[model samples]
Target: MTTTTETATHPLEILFQLQDLLLIARKKSEQKDRIPEHLQHVDAAFREISARRAERQERLKAAEARKKALEGEIADVAEKTKKYQGQLPSVKTNREYGALLNEIDGVKREVRAREDEILALEEQIATLKAEQAEVDATFPEEEARFEEQMAGWREEQAILAVDAERAAKRAAELRAGVDKKMLANFDRIAKARGGIAVVKVMMMASHTAACAGCNLRLRPQLLSDVRLSKEMVHCEGCRRILYWDHRADL
Candidate 1:
């Protein structure tokens, strides 16, 4: 670690400042993490409603297509019946007349079946249209609510942005007083370990020092060096920089 030429500030004090910087950084990051989570529900609802609307529209289209097909079939059957009626005058034998009449009756029955199917499809189309109208009527309200929710999220994000900027500025100021080499070590350690670079050495019941970061017992010589605060002291278990509180007994 880089040694500080400044005699006024102790190593422990410098590490404490760095620790405060880390806390500020972590708090700002945590606040940013919550912003996206806050909008998750609103976003999910919007997508789900949109999917349902699309499905309804698709169903409506299918029903309309079925009605058109049935209508076409009914028209063709009607034309065939008219042709069969025209053929009745040309039939010379009683058997031919009877066959023509039977064919016309079968065509009429088919036409009726197709007409009934068309009516059913029309009814289905009307129901779908009504449902679509209801969905459309509520759409504007849902859109407005979604917009308002997004606006609220933006407002919260703006406020959190200001807080994050303030915290970052304070952390930068704290970093300026810290030794360059020590800060670099802390930065490296923090990147590897969840933003924690420094920890206290607590006096354990066994008259030994334990690392607060990992709760592992520290060696006597390592604890002694940490107490002196003359150089960087790292915990053997977690490798975090260790410090000693002057008020704490060993």
Candidate 2:
């Protein structure tokens, strides 16, 4: 069971409204799971397209890095081949000359292999760039379409904004009316207890009343006090103030 802040207009009543309003004012959007299906689809589609575009850009970068590394390898191999070929003229024997020729051939083959890799990377890079360009061309339209399709979500967001503003204004008024010490106590408890300081009593399975916050069985005397609603009644276990909410869902 929950106590709504807007229900009873006393200090407790003000607290109930304030608690609910505080949470409401904090919300900027509906939870993902709670978003309506149509809006979810629109949002998901936009994200998917965006992810695809991002993936393409990332792949292009990786391809460019690989290409650069291969080009460096080719340069190093070419330099080695030049040094080996230069040693040919200074060879003292046919054996040394043949060894130098083999060394040059080996380096040449290595360079060819790296050049082939560079070519492949260049091709892949071009493909990625084309795909990215496609995304760039189409993504704006997709974004516009998503925004158009999410008209309902946009409307809901506007409503939430309005409600949050109203809640904030009302909360300010409620805070002004509350005793400063009580308000301080409420803020302390709410912060310590995940933003819920005022709570309703729950009837347990055995038909005994319990603290909704802590689910601790309330003493008869405490429950009686809660029912009287004369002053703040704190739950023994949770230390959260308890209110007798007749509208509590049993």
Candidate 3:
């Protein structure tokens, strides 16, 4: 990238300004889960109990559905057995009677198996329901224990949401003002460098310049080029865009 006329802002400087807004917005979101130290364990316990109850309820629903299906299967098997037994009076020879008896026995075995499964599913459903009831009875007291602290956490979360929203709006405006090529470069580098693409050259007491991103000493000619700010200069060590520090200490 080339330097602009004296009045125009350097592309890298614009990127630096854009970086500040983006970082602020990201930091605000990162703080969304902040909680009081005293209540952290209580909060975790409450969530754990709630999740346990939810799991129990889900399992109870599945068990009940299985029990209903097993009951229907038992009904179908019983009907088949009754139909086979009704054919016994029509047997004409010993061979015919034996075949009818075998059919009846097979269907009776199926009915017994379905009945056993239904019993097991009913037991599971009852256990899950009991567990759900226990949680329902105890959860309110736990919620009351941390009610005030949780309210404060909620309020702070709301405020953070507002701050993050404002930062997002401003960042969007800044990005819109930036050249697309510069914005793309900034995004690509920031993604590679943990959300920071531009950094000040670290001026040392020993009169050496270092790459702020990497802390590696800049080569003599590279340091000279960074000082001039005539064009975009990437640090040799870190490859992040380098700019002179404009703060008072520098």
| lDDT (C-alpha, whole model) for all candidates | 0.83, 0.82, 0.82
Which lDDT tens digits does candidate 2 get at residues 32-134?
2266775677677789888888888888999999888888888888889888877888899999888889998899899889888888888888888888887
Clashes of each: 0, 2, 0
Question: Best TM-score goes to which candidate?
Answer: 3
Candidate 2 lDDT at 149 equals 86
Query: Which candidate model has the greater TM-score, 2 or 3?
Result: 3
- State TM-scores per candidate: 0.54, 0.65, 0.81
CA displacement after TM-score superposition, residue 155 of candidate 3 (Å): 1.7
Tell me the TM-score of model 3.
0.81
Query: Where does candidate 3 clash, by residue pair?
Result: none
Model 2 accuracy (lDDT, Cα)? 0.82
Global Cα lDDT for candidate 1: 0.83
**Residues 72-95, candidate 1, lDDT per residue (tens digit)?**
888888999999999999999999
Mind giving the per-residue lDDT tens digits that candidate 3 earns over 8-103? 666677788888878888888778766668768878877887788788888888889888888888888888988988899989999999998999
- The parts of candidate 1 lying over 4 Å away from their true place are 1-9, 35-39, 47-141, 150-155, 247-250
Q: Best by lDDT, which number?
A: 1
lDDT of 1 at 38: 65
Candidate 1: pairs in clash: none
Q: How many steric overlaps does candidate 1 have?
A: 0
At residue 90, candidate 2 shows an lDDT of 88
